[model samples]
Target: MDRVEKQAALFNLPETIVPHSVLALGYPAEENKEPRESRYEENRVHFEKW
Candidate 1:
């Protein structure tokens, strides 16, 4: 929080511009994982009207 606050203050940014938390991630250990199940369905939409 301190680091992010300093940066934001230096730029004179508004509080809305500051994030509640910042995440800096490294590379994942494994690349092989099952694909996630999608939440959406394809055939729900109508062509021209609902």
Candidate 2:
């Protein structure tokens, strides 16, 4: 998150600890179970061109 220092304090992290990133997981909401379109696109791939 943008506020790493504040977040660290919430978890009781020591001041000396240097945090780069944080991982958070949670249960999905039931309403969000609907199908979604594919994000993959062939044009986005690159072989050797500019």
**Candidate 2: residue pairs that collide:** none
Worst 10 residues of 2 by lDDT: 41-50
What C-alpha lDDT, on a 0 to 100 scale, does residue 31 get in candidate 1?
92
Candidate 2 lDDT over 1-50, as tens digits, reads 55887766756666776567656746576667666796869996433322
Off by over 4 Å in 1: 19-50
Per-candidate alpha-carbon RMSD to the true structure: 12.1, 12.4
In order of listing, the candidates' clash counts read 0, 0
Error of 2 at 2 (Å): 5.8
Leading candidate by TM-score: 2
lDDT of each: 0.62, 0.63
Instruction: Give the CA lDDT, 0 to 100, for residue 11 in model 2.
Output: 60
